[model samples]
Every structure is written in structure tokens, then in C-alpha cells.
Target: MTVTFSLPPALEARTPAEPRDGVRLMVSRGTSVSHHRFTELPHLLDPGDLLVVNNSGTLPAALQTLDGVLVHVSTSQPDGSWLVELRDTDIARTGLRLRVPEGSLTLLRPFTSRLWVAAADVPGDRVSYLTRHGRAIRYSYTDRDWPIETYQNVYATVPGSAEMPSAGRPLTGAVLAALAGQGVLVAPITLHTGVASAEVDEPPYPEWFRIPPSTAGLISHVRASGGRVIAVGTTVVRALETGTGEGWTDLVISPDHPIRVVDGLLTGLHEPRASHLMMLTAVAGEDALRESYTEALREHYLWHEFGDVHLLLR
Candidate 1:
């Protein structure tokens, strides 16, 4: 289906001055919408409700050289190889070598357009190798070496993701305590998010994810007990959906593959034609998503990683 929604220049104000839960939260279920502080999340759900989170830790996927050009690496091949994409360069050499603190980086010419397949020789597993040789793959817009801690989810673990599962960012220590105090159940699953496709660009890359049987069992137990399964972000949705084998989901989310596991989804506003919007279409239907997105735009909701959050329930 062709998609359309409102885009407002004013919405940029919603960019989290602080990239945590600075996002405005909108909760929707049964034709109702309630705007509330993200901290108030626990109050909106019942005790024993299951909150499934993606524990895929973010990597310092961005690296720089003395020349000032930047590189963004996303997913890795299961065979311990990397499928990388490059940004901010017109130098299309057949092979490019990037110098890092501990090793030399090499790129195999354009996989497509501006993307290049790159890899580095390090001392251990890919994650460990990256830890020693790379910086968290960051966007030029950010312009800083945000410590690895800044890119990790509170409960993140495992190591294949290029970035944090951002929708869960608001569930801080205090919020976790609040959820615990309220008897809400929090379970973590791993789904490493590859490099985020730009709002204005749609790029293709391989999928990198790992979902444990125990996590699957936990989700099943929650649903079997009549507790709602709340997915924290699109990454979590992708992880849960991909792991469940509803079908081979190699691309974006869509209604053709309606979600079979998650009872609700908490995500951020996306831009026109953004691939993640396909996931929202799967969760809320193209019509409802357009309606909610229209409301978000008109309400001046922010966009991007540090923006407003959307909560939709089935």
C-alpha cells in the first residue's frame, strides 16, 4: 500500500535534549489515546504483565581516521564476516583500508551505491575484535565518541548489534524499580539492531540476530497466562517476529505478516518511507498507523532516535 503522513519541521524540538526517555509517550488501546510521561508506564498496565525487551547491546560501529571521513557498520555475516555501509565519502576505491587504534580496516568496494562490505582483523570473536578495534558506529549528526555505555539499553547484553534498541531507553533504573514495585514482569530477548537506515534513505543489509528458546518460552508463558506481551521497540518487534518464524522476514515489517506474538508495541515516530514504518504497518495496520502518525505530526511529536514514543495495543 502507498503510505502518507504529516511531517512537521516543529517536531524536531522533540529530539531528546537528553537522549534517554526524553520522548513524549502516547498509549493507545481500544480506540483510546492517553498522553503521559514515560515514567508513568507501569501505572498503565496490570501487575504480572510481561514487558519483552531486546537485550542486544550497541557496538561502537562508527570509526574515523585522520582524514575525517566516517564509516557506519551495521550487521555481520554469521560466518564472522561483516556487511558494512559507508557514509560521507565520494572516494570509491576498489579497496579501502581504514586505520584504527589497534588494527587496519579494509573495505571491499561498493556492495551497492554508497555501501561497502568491510571487515577488520582482530584478536577474538567479532564482538571482542570490534571492542578492541572500533568505536560505536555513530552518525555525523551526533559528532562525538559517546561511550559504549551511552548506546546500551539498561538490560542489554550479548554483542552483535550496531546500535541500541532505543524504544526501551526510557525504562531507567528508577523506572525498573517502579515496574518491580508494581509487580510487572520484565524479560529480555536479544535482537541486535544493525545500522539504522536513515530517515531519508533506505539501505539494504543482512540480518544479524539471536533468540534463545528460554526467551521464547517466557513470551509463551506470558501469553498463555493472559498477560499482554509488550514489545519495547521495533528492534524487539523484529527480533520477536523474526525469531518466531512467522515467515522469513528479510525486509521491513508489514500487514502481510501481521504480528503473531506481541500484544502491544512501543516505538518511535518514523519518517516518510522509512523501512521501520513497515514494522509499524504490521503491528497497527496501514490505516491506523497513518492515523496515529498524523496525530503525532500535528501534535508536533519529535522524530529520530531521541524523539517521542508510540504505544499501540491489540
Candidate 2:
């Protein structure tokens, strides 16, 4: 199905909501749609429901090469290397080596011709090297530079993701406490997201993920007790659906696929024709998904990482 809509430039949120939970939330239960503040999430859920969140923290993945060109570190390879996306120019080829003050970088292979697998000649761990030199990756849509903390969720713990699991951004401490007071269980799984691609309909690349035995057991128990397993983000859904204890996932959720684990999804308003729209369709069904988007657009809901949220319940 071809889903398209006009996302006005004014609707792109330049910064996060001041109270965080002040963001608008569009709730879609089957074909029914309702509006509420993100703070009302607890009231919308049943007592026995389980909310699964991604605890993987954001990483400062953007760094400059010797020539001052920007390179975004997308994913960390099993080896010490990293999958990187070179911006502006296209000189990043197989076996191309770049010299930097921190270390030398050797391009291994092209991840997508624009992105390449490259290794840095650092003495210490790659994470440490990046921590010392890198800055958080930002798109042109984001008006100004913000700290990495701005990209983090309230429950973020593990450090791995190149970008924030932004769907959970509106979940403040008060919201979490409210959900807990309502007897809703919360759990965490890790999925280190890579740099988001602008290429439409492209499948997600393989990324490291870990679903602990405790979280898995909780999911099974929730299912057995007839509780809805609400995924906080697409990253959480990807991790829980494909991960055991630890592994890499290339699972692509589409309309053709059946969602076996997640019963609901809390996500941001994705762009029209974006790959994420297909995943939303898998959870809410196409008609509901379309209606929700139309409502969001009509109501002038913000879009992107720092925008409003949509909760799709089945």
C-alpha cells in the first residue's frame, strides 16, 4: 500500500517538549482513535499489561575525518571496526585509508556504497575512543546542536545505540511511577540502533540486541496471563521478536508478517512512505494506521524524534 502525506516543515519539532510528557499522544484501538497527553498513558492501559522499553542509550556517533568531512558511525561490528556513513563527498571506497589525529581509519568494505565498514587505529576500546571524540548525530531537521543527554530516555542504562529509541522519550519519571501504581509491569531489552537512513522502503540493517532471560520469562508470563505486551518502540519490538539472550537482528516487520509477541506499540509519527509505517501497519492494520496518521496530520501533531507519540493497540 502507498501511504503518503504532506509533513509541513513547521510541524517538525525543533526541540523536545519542556515537560517531556507534555507531548500529545494519539491512541488508536482498532479503528477507534482518541487524543490525550502522554501523561495519560497509565490510564489507558489495563492493570495486567506489560510495557517493554529499550534501555540502550544513545551514542555520539558523528565524528570528523582529517579533511573535516563528517562521518556517522552507524553500527559496531563484532570486530573492532565500525560501519560508517560518509557525508557530503563520496570518496569512501574499499581499502581507502584516512589519517586522523586520534588514529588512522581504514575503510574495509561498502555497507551501502555510502556507508562503509572502517577500522580505527586506536589503542583502547572503540567506545572509549568515540566517547572522547564523537558528537551525537543530528539531522538537518533538528535546528541546533544538543547534548547526548537530550537524546536519552528517562530509563536509559546501557550505552550502545547510535540514536535514541525516541518513542520512549515522552515517558517521564512521573509517568513510569503512574504506570507502576496502576499495576502495569515494565521491563527492558537492549537494541543498539544504527544511524537512521533517509532511503525509503530500505530494510533495517543488522544490529546488536539482547533480550535477557528475565524479560523473556516476563513476556511469557504476561502472555499466559492474557496481558498485553506493549512495546515502547520499534527497537523494543525488533529486539523482543528476534533476540534471545544476545545476538544480531535483521528482522524487517512488514504487512505480510504476523506479530507474534507484541500486542501494542507506542511510537512516534513516522514520515509518509517511511519503512516504519509498515511496522505500524502490522500492529494497527492498514486502515487504522492510515486513519491515525490522517488524524495526527489534521490535528497538527509534530513529527520526528522530538515529536508527539502514537499508541497502537490491538
Considering every candidate listed, which one attains the maximal lDDT?
2
List candidate 2 stretches off by more than 4 Å.
199-201
lDDT tens digits, residues 186-287, model 2?
A: 999999999885544466889999998999999999999999999999998888777578988989988888889999999998976888888888888989
Write the residue-wise lDDT of candidate 1 on 1-314 in tens digits. 45676566666533233646555888766446668778788888888788888787887777665456666666766455566665655664757776655655578656656666666664566677667656865543453556777767778767778776778877788888888899888887776677764634563345655566777787888888889888898877776776653222365567787688888898877777777777777777766776677677666777766677889887
TM-score of 2: 0.96
- Against the hidden true structure, what lDDT does model 2 obtain? 0.87
CA RMSD of each candidate after superposition: 3.0, 1.3
lDDT of model 2, residue 89: 41
What does the lDDT read for residue 297 in candidate 1? 68
What Cα-based lDDT does every candidate model obtain?
0.70, 0.87
Every model's TM-score: 0.86, 0.96
